[model samples]
Target: MATRTRRAPPKARTTSGPAFEVDAARLPPLGMPPAEFLRDYWQKRPLLVRNAFPGFVSPIQPEDLAGLACEEAALSRLVAHDAAHDRWMLRHGPFPEEMFPEMPDHDWTLLVQDVDKWDADVAALLAHFGFLPRWRIDDVMVSFAAPGGSVGAHVDQYDVFLLQAQGQRRWQIDASEAMGRTAPPLDFRDDVELRLLQRFNPTHDWVLGPGDMLYLPPGVPHHGVAVDACLTFSVGMRAPSAAELLGDFVDTLAADADDALRYRDPGLAPPKSPGEIDADAMERVVEALNLLRMNDPERLGDWFGRFITVYRSGGQVMPGEDARSRIEVEWDLQQGARLHRHPFSRMAWRKAKRGARLYVNGAGHALPARDAARIADNAVLDGPLYASLSEAGRDRVFELMREGHYHLDLRQDDE
Candidate 1:
């Protein structure tokens, strides 16, 4: 569905603290360095961090989030818990403002996704998690719940960090890892939009306050319920399914293959049983399939860069001016202004045998090896650095700007 946006961007309810520092070296709350955190906890186990963002004030408020839910372009949902029936139900959003006041004060929750794309402060929270690679990130989802509301006991296929922003929420995660996507033993209620577990057993449980956070790896069953009216933010990471990766390879990897070659049986053997496909025919088919295999590093790297960097969100936007002529690009480059990549655009790259493949929003570009490293490492390129680019490299910068992926980093006093 398209986002029903207005003439001006919606201001966040509140902004983050002016001087709340985010250090890339020591990730606070976890009390662990990036290297240690990656080695011990990441993808291996869950980590509970108390006061992850001390004195943290959410940029958007519960009410503002509710307003965004009513926008057709923004993706939102309402989940209501029916404790009497021990079940949960969901309603798709594009909700009306009037529908909220009459809602039951308890047992309900409103969730809005991709908040980072719209709010700058929410986007800043992602920078703190820079310990992980950029391309793997999905989006930020913010939820506001009334007293006793819950999404039920369930496990997610992607990794997520649940950050408590307001009030309190008691969370519980299963100890035995009994719940899984492929294997099922848990009880589920029918006629519900959520795939919620009927019962949950926990080896770990905690009541998180403001700034507290819990990180769970993929396939960990967990449940959370509001102690009172509260808010939570989820930073989810993307992981492609096996089918998706294979589909990319099959559909994309050998698209440039020579179509002129046809299957031939030079060594024809007469078989007594005509029903069976002979070994020679099978060999030819297998050989052809092998030829299309993504075994080569450069070929695979090119495909992977494009595959992972594809943006999948309803609110992605091009920020800069469209139809920018070369003169305009040249003027912008020479103006000595800092350039920034838009938050909605996804970018990634891999070092090829000679140069590197630069991927942005699902498209790939080949550039010199030296420049490729600079592109991968540098998210913000200063004016002097932009001017220093060769003719081809400069043209690439212009293309990104024209596409609205790159532009002047002019942080407005207000969003």
Candidate 2:
């Protein structure tokens, strides 16, 4: 499927004036300082912050969500539960307009992934969570549900901040670590997409209004039913398992390695039984594998840089940023114009004293020591900040802009 660039322009029009500000302040929504929250709750337990975003209005309407679902490159699904028949149904989307209206009125949900990639205002909300490492952040998934509608009780492996963007939803969360262990694993019907636990004994339950947020850690079973027509924005994080990380890194390493770098058997010994592998052979294999330096400082940095900076498969896209030339962009930046990172672009880095491994998209590049360190410190360079940089620093700025991760639009009339 082709990637979907948002119908909405990168710039939003403001009423009466050009001034447009959507976020209140870059503060932890839960009233705790970022340090305190990260230390106490992140990946450790659940935290509910009521009206965390005070006077917050949803950036997009329910209709907007449905419209996006009809587009190619949109990963969407329709989930329905039939109470009368005691059956659950799941369907993938690119759904036709008529299909939604025909869905059961009171027990269905429409979920669309990476809304921030499509809407600037929705993407602005991510800046609020700047307290966390930006590389670990994933896309913002938006879901709309009918009254009494839910996706079922299932546990997510990664952490999620379920922000109620519109109307209200009743959330029932199972705090018990067992994920409601009722059986070895009961056979669920074919209709469900998740291994939904049948009996969910919730320790935390609440009806969340617009702007109300719930933070759930990994492995906690959670179920949410809409109290009325509503929209929920799930700010998800990446939490790859150790095995997954190693597997991908191994694949990456092998791609660049010489085919002749194979196992050496200089001291071969015959086994007593041909079917029985000797422990000496196994030891030799382990030693050869260890030589790959899976844990070496140099290789670890490379793996971390590429793994965290890969673009989401079907997320948002920024226009014209990649097509611009460095000198042309540097000239524009010299005029004191603003450049912002595209909402859909994922950028992260690993720093060293002399330089840094700055990864944008799936590729890693070396950055000047100061420029890289400053990004690690502040993560962005706005107009004034760009002016503050030396000529070398400003040139580095142009490189990021040309790469398409950071965007600049000269079409807008002087502010």
TM-score of decoy 2: 0.83
Error of 1 at 382 (Å): 3.6
List candidate 1 stretches off by more than 4 Å: 1-29, 177-191, 278-280, 311-336, 376-379, 388-391, 409-415
Q: Give each model a TM-score.
A: 0.84, 0.83
Task: Tell how far residue 233 is off in model 2, in angstroms.
Answer: 0.9
lDDT of 2: 0.72
Summarize candidate 1's per-residue lDDT along 77-123 as a digit string, tens digits: 99997788866678998999999889999999899999888787888
Model 1 Cα shift for residue 275 (angstroms) = 2.0
Report the C-alpha lDDT of model 2 over 44-160, residue by residue, as the tens digit.
667667667987899999999999999887889888888788678888989898777676669889999988888888888988888887777787999999988888888788989
TM-score of 1: 0.84
Candidate whose lDDT is highest: 1
What shift in Å separates residue 251 of candidate 1 from its native position after superposition?
1.0
Best by the TM-score measure = 1
